[model samples]
Every structure is written in structure tokens, then in C-alpha cells.
Target: MTSHSAPKLAWTYENRLLLILFMTFGFVFFDRLALSFLFPLMSAELHLTNAQLGMVSSALSLTWALSGAATGAWSDARGTRKPLLIAAVLGFSICSALSGLVAGFVSLIAFRALMGIAEGPVLPLSQSLMVESSTPSRRGMNMGLLQGSAAGLLGAMIGPPVVIGMATAYGWREAFYVSCIPGLLIAFCIWRWVREVPPGGVRHAQAEGAATQAAGGTTVSRWALLKERNILLCVLISCCFLTWFVVIISFAPVFLVENRHLSPSGMGVVMTCLGAAWVLWGFAVPAISDRIGRKPTMIAFALIAAVCPIVLIHGDSVWALGTLVFVTYTGLGCFTLFMATIPAETVRPRAIAGALGLIMGAGELMGGFVAPTVAGFAADKYGLQFAMWMSAVGAILACVLSFALVETAPAVLRRRALACAAARLDTQNVGGR
Candidate 1:
């Protein structure tokens, strides 16, 4: 009998997990953005003031920030991501569906806040899982797809067009109703397939929890994370970047529709352009960072990001506007770099979830909660265009702050270390001779 070696399957656990998380995080954004897309249509009928709309926008952000911080630490300590992951996906989807039933501002924000509670930990937890599964070389790309492109593609690219079409035909409420279905299905998939991974990748879930417990990932305090310079810089960047992103997405659709005098369809077209840009630049930036270094990638992309809102405000034709939107919307790619990549590289594996949660929470608190409310008041008092300017300022601030971020990409650091080692070897050999 001849013994034959079996060919290996190319589709590994890493690929499978990435695909699942890509969908899971993507749907989270899709449901979150549904309200923003439907706002222009519902604002008048629901009698929402600009400030109220801003608050409504911030509502989910507030709760999400708090929930994410708590749950991220909880997951790290417990070393159980699947149950919390399943619960968040299921809870948020149901809450998003309930938004369709709200007739007034109070109920709308209430539902949004509840949705935030459920959606808060999805990103950090998903990232923790991905980091565990990903090869060192592919960490930036994998996490970028998970954090940036997934949201951009589903929430921004596909979401605006679909929501607008539904709102146009069936009315805005129906769009919300339909958005809930995807998250529910994603939750079931996660429950069935997703499992915990040990810090060093040697142990399975059964052993991981105990190993993780001994390593002290569970007992680390949130305040202690602030001791690291990279974490501090990331948190600050999150504040400014979130201000730019949240304020624009929250107000730009309305700005395009009312301030630019765009028809709903025209607004949808422009929004879709932004989404497409988001999808392209989102993953590309982080992948580039993997090679070039995270700091330069952020500085360059944020410079372009600062220009996006300006072009939207100034460009007259849809062709001109759409082209600029795609070109300047490069900041989404930087999100994963600072939010998850930088933190993951800086902190110990056990505390990664906590670090991710803190960065997100701080950003949400300021950028998500505070910025939108202020911009809304500015919109009402000055004009909607003011909101766009605010977005630009946020990007500019992030660009300046990027100067301070320590280089953390593994490939970059590895190459530098190799060069130093080679130089040391040459000097030692020469001295001996």
C-alpha cells in the first residue's frame, strides 16, 4: 500500500473568522447609519429641531462609549467574547428596529441610546478576536478590513443608496424595519462558529480563559492604560477624528439636501460617492501603514481628510463634487490604525480589549456626543455649512496630532531592528579583525 500525503485546505480558521467578523461589524454600521440617511426625510414630519437631531445623533454614541469600555474590560477579564458578542449583536439589531416606531425626539434618542449599549463593544471584541487569529504580517490589513472598510462598505456605500430607495418608495420607517434583519442573522452565525483564542495562539478556548486570568489582563484598570504614550495619543486622535467623521456623517446628508438644494436622489448619489471613497481608502490606508509606518499614513490621509468637507461645500457640479469626495475621504483608513492597530501593538495581549475600548469611549464621548450637538446648534444659528467647516477643523487637528504618534507597525519596527542588528554585527566583526 502506498501512503499519500494529503493536500492542505487553503481556507483556514483565520479566513473564516475574518469573513464572519467583516459581516458582523459591517452590519453594525449599516444599522447605525440608517437613521442618518432617513433623517432628511423624517426631520420635517417628526418636527425635529437641528439641535434635537444633533442630540439624537449623539445619543447612541454616548451609550456606546460607556458600554464599550465596560464590556471590553469584562471580556478581557472573563476571556469570553462569544456570549457578549452574541448578546450585543442581537440586542442592537432589535433596538435599531424599534427606532422605526418612534414618533418624536425623546423616543428616537431613547432607542438610539439603547442601540448604542448593544453596539458599543462589537468593534473592540471583534478586533480582539481578529488580532488573536491574524498573522503578524497581516494584522493591519485584517483589522483595517474589520474596522474601516466593513463599516464604509456596508454603512456608507451600500447603506445610503438602499435606505434612500426604501424611504422613497415605502417611507423612512420601512427602511429601519428592514435594517434589523441582517444583524439578527449575523448574531446566530457568531454563536455557532466563533470561539475564543488564547493570547499566544497555542491554547484553545478551554485553556485560554485560565491562562489569560493568570496573565492579569482581567485586573488592569482603565486609568492605567493612560500611562502609555501611544494609547494617550490614540485617545486624543480618536477625539478629533471622531469629531470630523461623526459631525460630517451626521450633518452632511442634510447639508447636501437642504443647503445645496439637492433633491433626495441627488443627495443619495453624493452620499454614495462618499461611501465608495470610504470603502476604497478605508482599508488601503491601514495596509499602507503596515509597510510605510502608521504615523506618516495618518498625517497624509488626515491632510486629505481635512479637505473633504471643503470640497463638498464648494463644488457646484455632482461630477466635481463626487470626484473630490472620493479623493479626500481617506481618513476612514486611519481609523483602524489608531483605534485598534496602534493599541494592539502598544499594549500586552491581555489588555488589548481594554485599550481598544478606552480609545473608542473617549472618542465617542467628545467627538460623537459633544461635537454633533455643538454643530447642530451652529447649524441652526449660523447655517448648515458651518457644520462642514467644523468637520474640516477636526481633520486638521488630527493631522497635527499625528506628528506625535510613535511608530508601531510591526513590519516597520522589524525592518528597523534588522538594520540595527546588521550594523552591530559589522562593527563587532571589524573590531575583532
Candidate 2:
């Protein structure tokens, strides 16, 4: 009997890469957000205050911002992704496991900050890789999928229950320990499956060629690249969006339980709606934007998100609150659009990671680090419900900023350019006739 080799499946390298990165990003969110679910328990055990909790969370963001900027530049210069990604996963996983061993606020902050240093590069770097891998037409959709997995599936939906349940049954410490396992597993998968693209390589060459053609062979320096109007707008928009995100994630659970009188389990249920909305809109909005335009989709969603906190303050029932949460997240799909896709499309391919890093760092500094601290202080002094207005204000600002964005959708730009060319041809032909 002749032995035949089995037929290769349809799963391409891109498919495997996406699957691994998806899981990796999911674990990143899962690990980071596990703290949110455990906040009540941790605050109780450690005798911490709201301000202290915000400070601890802010520590992570501060370091993450600094490190992300540095590492993103480093990644761009180095032009290799696999080794850095593997190292990041390992570092974060170890720190996550150690978080379970912390005894006080100081130790907790230290550990989380360390984890942040490791994690800072993951998002921008992974995004850079994914952008290089995807065709231009599908770029928004691909990025949305990655962000959705992190924010919706793993972070919001599954993370709360699993982490909270573990904290309830075993201990919050055990939950931390368990969360690290996935990171380690994913690190191995990345090492085995992912390939690196170096600087001045095929993707970089293509991007340079495109840039040369577009600019009539004039090359822009990296410094000049940073001065572009779109880059500045992207940074501001990111800050606004992140302010909304950090406030909601940091204090919403407490507000639900204490202000609205929902139980922990009930808060989890409401939070699940956040995940579902993120998944639904994260995929749908970006996909739609591919057809329509990023600016309109962003403006519409941001307006919808801006109203959620106002309605939520008045919402008395779980259904009402959940629906509002869903609406809020639908707007947040623009987060992926603004931070990853827009900045990527705006810059030369070689500068993608660095530009993303700058955008992420700026957002994290203002939104992630400062916003939560201010909100926590407000919650302590005024009320948790009042603190939610901060997010509402940020959302409104983001909606306004959406209008300033240059339409960067490749398909849309191509269609418009073609239409203009066709119209010019028609005019010339009529004049000849």
C-alpha cells in the first residue's frame, strides 16, 4: 500500500497569524481587566480608597505610555516583530502571576506598572504587523476584529465572570495566577507561527514606492512625517476616546453596585452588554466604514455614545442600563479606527509603528492615566454618578473631532479619484466633439 501525504487544509499563513494574534490580544485584555472585576474584593481586603485605586491604575497607564512610545520606535527601527512579541508575552505573563502575590497598594502598583512596560508594545506592534498582512480594502475590518476580541470578547464578556468567579471561590490572587497561563501559551504560539518583516523589506519597499509616486518622488523625513495635520488630529481624537474608555472601565462597576444598587453579578450582566456591543459594532461599523467613509461612521457613533451616560444616569433597570452600555460601545468602534487604522494609513509604512506608538502614548497619558485619577477623585468627593459625566463630555468632544479627520479609506479615495478623472475625460471629449 502506497502512503499518500494528507491534503493541506485551506488555512493560510495569514489565517494562522490572525488567529494567534487574536488570541494574544484577547489574553492581553483579559489579564489587564481582571483587576477591574477584583477591585471590590481587593479594595476591601487592602483597605484602599477610590483615589488609591485610580492611582494604581494610573501607574500602569503612565508606564505603558512611556514604554509603548519607546518600544514602538524600537520595533520600527529593528523591523522584526516575532521576537519582541514573544518577549512581551512572557514578561507580562510573569508580572500577572506576581500580581497575585502583592500585599499592599504599593506592591500592586509596582507589579501592574511592570506589566505595563511589557504590554505597551503589544498593541502597536501587533497592529503594525496586522496592517502589513492585510489588503488595503480589508484593513479596517481586520483591525476591528483584533480590537473587538480584546475589548469585547475577552476583556468585557468572559473576563469579568471568570475573574470574579475565581476571586469568589478561590481568591483574587488565584484569579491573577490563572490569567497568566494564557499569555504564556500564546507566546509559544507566536514564536512558532508568526514570521517577521524587517525594515526596507517587501512591505516597506511597496509603501515607499507608493509614497514616491504620490509625492512626485519627494521623500519626507521622519520629523516632517510627525508634523502632518492628520497625525495631530489622530492624537487629539485618541485622547478623547481614551478618556471616555478609562473612566467607564475604572468606575462603572462601582457605580452600578453602589449608586444603582445592583449586585456584583448584576453588574457583570450589564457589563456583558458592553462586550456584546463592542463585538457587534466593532465589526459592523468598520466594515460599513469601508463602504461609506470613516468620518461619517465615526461622527454618527460618537454622537450615539455621547448620549449613553446621560441616559444611563437616569436608567433604573438592568435592561435600560445594558442597552445604553451597548450603544456606548457601538461608538467605541472608532477607537480602533482612529488609533490603529487611520494613523497607519496616514503615515509611510516604515513609520507605522512609531506613529501608532505616539498616538497610543498620548492617549494613554491623558485618557488612561489622568482621566481615571480625576474621575476617582470626583467619585470620592461628589458622587459616582456625577463622575460619569466626564466620559460623556469626552465622547462629545470626540464626535466633534471626527469631522476634522481626512477620509483615509483606500477604497473610498480610489472611487472618488476615478470619478473625478472620468468627469474630466467626459468634459474633454465633449469639447473635442
Candidate 3:
């Protein structure tokens, strides 16, 4: 009998886990961003105002912010991530499908609010799981790719045209319905493949295991988590990132078509390049940063992101525009990598999910609420070009603020210790004990 070597699996169980993570994120990107591509079609059919449209978008963000804390806390207490992930997916998918059915602004906004409520918990829970699942040796690479796939790469780029085509063929509602199919599939996959690990370390799959005790219920309060200055600083830094992120993603296509005189196809291509650049950074940079340390890379990215907008606003050529897009996406991608590291550095084992909920919810609210509407008003009063340029200025502010954040790398432990000390002193004095 001839013995044959066992067929080597192309992807180990671990690699398959990464693929599942990527797919989950891909659905999120598609669901969230497809709205922007469908916006024009919806506007034309419903004859909506910019404010009304912005309101609809804002509704989702607002609910996300509102519900995030509760959702995160609940997930942490339950010690299971699958429930939250599955619920978020189903809620968003159902609401997204319902969004297609709405005939008026009021109905659409209500459904969006429902979607936001569901959408809120996903990031913190998913990410906490991803990081825990990863070997510390490769955490940054895993994180960077996760952010890149979901935020920068396929979600924003490929989604636009797909949504656009569906809208063109069937109507805006049909487009949303089509988008819903993929998310449902993804939710099922996550249910089957993804397992929730405890935040502090590895945990048990059954009731009476060592891992279970290792991940036992956290005693930390939400108030205590917020009191950590490093965490707060991270949140403050994220505000800037969120502002720029929302402004660009929400308004870029509109600006390209209205201000730059690009055809829909042309605008789509520009956005595609921009999205692709982000993906490249997500895939390439964070992994490298894991080796070099998160702080130096974050600071460098912030500084560069600050400059990218200025270049993007003034450039006229297609090549120049493409170059600017790449630069901007790179900076944005770096900011994302920075954001992912905060919980790893700040939150204790038990409270990671809650911390993430607070951070993401707050950032999403500010970004969705203040940035885009202000940009829209600016576009109405001044021009789309000016609005975009102004948003870039906001990005620069975010960069400047990011300088204050303690680096997430292990080398920055001294700084973190110092910050914690200063924070403790401030609190002690403030308490008047």
C-alpha cells in the first residue's frame, strides 16, 4: 500500500478565521457605504433636501452612539460575542431592506435609526474578538488588514458601483434589497465560524474550564473606564479622525461630480482609487508598525494625513488627483490603525468591549452628526470644492490633536505610566480627599 502524505491545507484553522473576519467586515463596509452611492438616486426620486438626506444619515449615527454603551456592556457581561454580532447583522440587514421600502423621508429616517442601533455594537465586539484570537506576534498585521478590508478597500470602492447599478436597474429600494442578501450570508457564517474569547486572555468553551475563570465577569464600571486619561486622550484623538473620515466618505462623490465636473463613471473611478489606496495601507502599514511600534507609525501617519488634504484641494490633473487620493487614504489608514490599538493598550481584560463601545459610539456620533452636515452647509453656501478643502483642514486638526495621544507600542510604556500617574494625581486633587 502506498502511503500518501495528508493533503496540506492551504489555510490553517487560523487563516480560515482571518478569512471569516475579512468577510464579516466586507459586509459591514458594503452595508454602511452603499448608502452614499445610492444617495443620488434616492435624492432624485424623493426630491430630498441636503439637510433631510444628511438627517437620515445622521439618524443612524446618532442611534449608534446612543446604543453602543449598553450593547458593549451587555456583551461583556454575557461573555459571548456571537450573540451581539449576529444581532447587529440581522438588525442592520433588516433595516437596510426596510430602507428600500420606505416612500418618505420620515419613514426612511426611522428605519435608519433602527439600523444604527444595531450597527453600534459591531466594531468593539468584533475587534475585541479578533485581537484576542490573534497571536501577539501578528496582532498589528491582523488588525491593519481587518481595518483596511472593512474601511478602506473593498467596502467603499466595489460597493458604490454595485449599489449604483442596482439602483439604475431596479430603483433605490431594490438596490438596498440586493445589498441585504450578502449580509445575511455573512451573519450565518459568523454564527458558524466565529467564537468569542475572553478579553484578558484565552477562555474556556465549556462552563468549568480554566479559560472561563480567566475571562470571568469584569468588575470595572463604565465610569472607571472613562476616567482613564489615556483612554480619554485616545477618544479625543479619534474625534478628529472620525470627523475627517465621515466628511470625506460622505461627501467625496458629491464633490467630484458637482465641483470637478466628472461623469458618474469618472467620479466612481476616483472614489475607487481612493478606497483602494486605503486598502493598500491597511494591508501593508499596520503589519510593519507591529514590528516598529504603533506610536512612531501613528505620529508619522497623522502628520502626513494633515498635509494630504491641502494637496488634494489644489491639484487639477487626473494623475495629481490620484496621487492626492493615495496620500489621503494612507493617512486615513494610519489613523485607523492607531484607533484599533487604544483598547489593547488602555482597557483592562474585562472591560475591553465596553471601552470600545464608548470610543466608537462617541466618535461615530460626532462624525455622523456634526461633520457631514456642516460640510453640506458649506457646500451650499460656498462650493463643493471649498467644502472638501475645509474638511481637509479638519483632518489637519485631527493630526495635530493626535500628537497628544500616547503611542500604542510597548516602547511607549514609560509615557503611558507617566500619563497614568498624572491622571491619578489630578483625580486625587479633584476629589478633595
Candidate 4:
């Protein structure tokens, strides 16, 4: 894999970078979810209240949004990513480890916020890199694996068990201490293996930039990005989808145990279904989009997403509910399209990272910061089902909004172009005959 001729090097480089980025994002999520996974132990030990927990989560999200946007813009302007990415991995890992040392609520908030600051740029930076390196045909799938599958498997599915098991055996603090190890290893891998951008990617990006410039897009400031319809729709979609995601993740377990009167074991099983669905559709939806086009895939998956919250409310029998949830929980795949793939395809090559960061920041601010508070308030005032219904509303809005999106899938667009060319040629031949 390492030694190859130029033609083969592109392939090798693409795979190597994909594998590393996959692991990189996986560790990012692993570290990111550590707080929630260890919250019970930390809450008990620090005597923290529900209000403190919300504040703590919001603190991280606030910094995450700001840092993602700022860091992305910085990298795009400077024309660099590797060093920043390496620093981000190291920074977040250390911060996650520091979580074990927190004495009280304030310290926890400080470390989590620091962690978010470091972790924020990882998505846009990694995605921009992925977009550059990948072949046009595989872009959707590569980004899907990097963003969806990796996070779903490492963070959502396997993370809780490992964290809880370690906390149970040693202590939650000890679990945090050990969490830094994976990030350190992943950072080392990136430092050694990754390139700033591949030769093909650089050329491809140049070609893309030429096309954009010819289309009268000379520069891609954040404000300029907003002027593009696809970027605007993607940002709004991010907000709504984040609401769908955050509310479900935040309240699902408690809602099951308390509101639905499901036993603890039953609730755990239902949540497990969510983790499974997150992993399965994470890559599947985007890969399918590669063939069918991003618009149809997005609309169809979002329609599926709307049904998941309702299924949670009314679904009966552990086996039946898990199946229903898994089937309907198709939003993770759509996330890759809207959050990374759509933006990358729509914007000029230079501003890929900034566009991603802006959408992410806006989404996190609404879904991560504001939505939770509002959902929690509704839950307290009414009931947890109110939060579930709110999630459904978010998904439905995202579906409706997706109708306005222009087709961005390379394969689909290429097909249309070829068909148009054929039609033009046929008309010319008939006139000549």
C-alpha cells in the first residue's frame, strides 16, 4: 500500500486516508460521548442536578459551534489542515482525560468546553480532506463511512458498554483516564500517515475551482456561501435534523423508563435498537444516494426519520419495537448528504471546510444548544412525549425542506449531462440526414 506508482498511489492514498479519517472520527465520537456515558457516576459523585447537566452539555455545544466555524474559516484562508487536525486530536484527547480530574460542576464544564473547542474542527477539516482525496463516484460513500458509520459504531453503539463496564470495574474517573489512550494513538497515526492533500485531489480541486470561478464565483466568504441556495437549505436542514437527533438521544431512555413504564432492561434494549439503526443506515443511506441522487435519498430517509419518534411512543414488545426503530431510524445517512456531501459538492473547493463548519455551527447552536433547553422545558411542563413529538416535527420539517435542494450527486448529474449530449447529437444527425 505504501509504495506505488502515481496511478496506483492515488488509490492507495485514498484508502489510507479514508481508513485513518474513519478511525479519527470514531475516536472523536468516543471521546465526545464519554461525558454522557459517565454522567450517572459523575452526577452521583459531584451531587449535580439536572440543571447543571443541561448547562454542562450546552457549554460544550456552544464552544463546539464557535470553534468549528472559526477553525474551519481559518484553515480555508490559510490553505492548511494537517497540523490543525493533529492538534485538535491531541487537544480533545487530553481534555477528555482531564474529565476524570474534575472536582465539581464548574471543572467538568471547563474541561468539556475545552474538549469541544478542540473537537469542533475535526468534522469540517476531516470532511474537506475527504472531499479532496476521494474519487467523484465514491465521495458520498467515503464521507458516509467517515461521518456516519465510524461515529455510529464507536460512539453510539460500542462506547456505552465499554465506558460503563470500565466505570463499573475501576471507576468513572479511571474510565476517563483511559479514554485518552485511543485519541493519542489515532493522533500518532494521522501525524505519520496523512498528507495535506493528494496530487489528484489538488488537481481535482483546481478543476473544480476553475469551474466555479467561470460561473462567476470568485470567492467564497461565509456571507457568499449563504447566497447559494443549496448552502442555505442545507444549513436550515441541519438545524431541524439536529433537533430530531438531539431530542431523541437526550430523552429517549428516560422517556422509556419513566413515561412508558418500561423496565430498565426494556429501556436499555430499545436504546440498543437506536444504536444499531444509527450504524446500519449511517453508511447505507449515503451509498444509496450515490446511485439514486441525493435529493430522493434525503427526502425518503427523512420521511422514515419522522416516524421513529412516534414508533417509540406506541411500539409494543421489545423485539417488535427494536425492529420498527431500526427500520425508521434512517436519518444518520441523510446527515452525511446534508452536512458534508451536499455542502462539499455545492461550494467551491476552497470554501468546502468553511461551508461545512457554518452549517455545523448553526445546527449545533440550534439543535445542540437551544433545542435541548426548549425540549427539556416542554418535557417538564407537559411530559416526555412532548419531546418525542418535537423530534418528529423536526424530522418532518427537514423532509419538507429537502424538496427545495438541487441535485448534487455526481453520478446522477453526470447521467443527465450525457443524456442531454446524446439528444443534441441526435438532433444534429437528423438535420444532416
In terms of TM-score, the best-performing candidate is 1
lDDT winner: 1
Give the root-mean-square deviation of each candidate in angstroms. 2.8, 4.3, 7.7, 3.1
Q: What is candidate 3's local distance difference test score?
A: 0.69
Candidate 4: RMSD to truth: 3.1
Ranking by lDDT: 1, 4, 2, 3
Q: Give me the overall lDDT of model 2.
A: 0.81
Instruction: State every prediction's TM-score relative to the real structure.
Output: 0.94, 0.92, 0.85, 0.91
Can you write out model 3's per-residue Cα lDDT over 90-151, one digit (the tens) per residue? 88888788888888888888888898888787777777777666666667777777767566
Model 4 clashing residue pairs (backbone): none
lDDT pick, better of 1 and 4 = 1
Which 10 residues in a row give candidate 2 its minimum summed lDDT? 1-10
Expressed as tens digits, the lDDT of each residue in 1-433 for candidate 2 is 1122211221255556677887888788788878877888888888878887788778888888898888888777656667888999999999989999999989999999999999888988888888887767678888888876456788888888888888889998998988888888899898877877522226683467566768786434446656877788878887888888778778877788888898888888888888788778877888888989888888998888777677667887998889877876676588788888888888878778888888889989999999888888878999887668998898889989889889988888999999999999999999999
Clashing residue pairs, candidate 3? Answer: 204-211
Model 3 CA deviation exceeding 4 Å by range: 1-11, 198-201, 204-218, 308-312, 317-319, 411-433
By TM-score, the better pick of 2 and 3 is 2
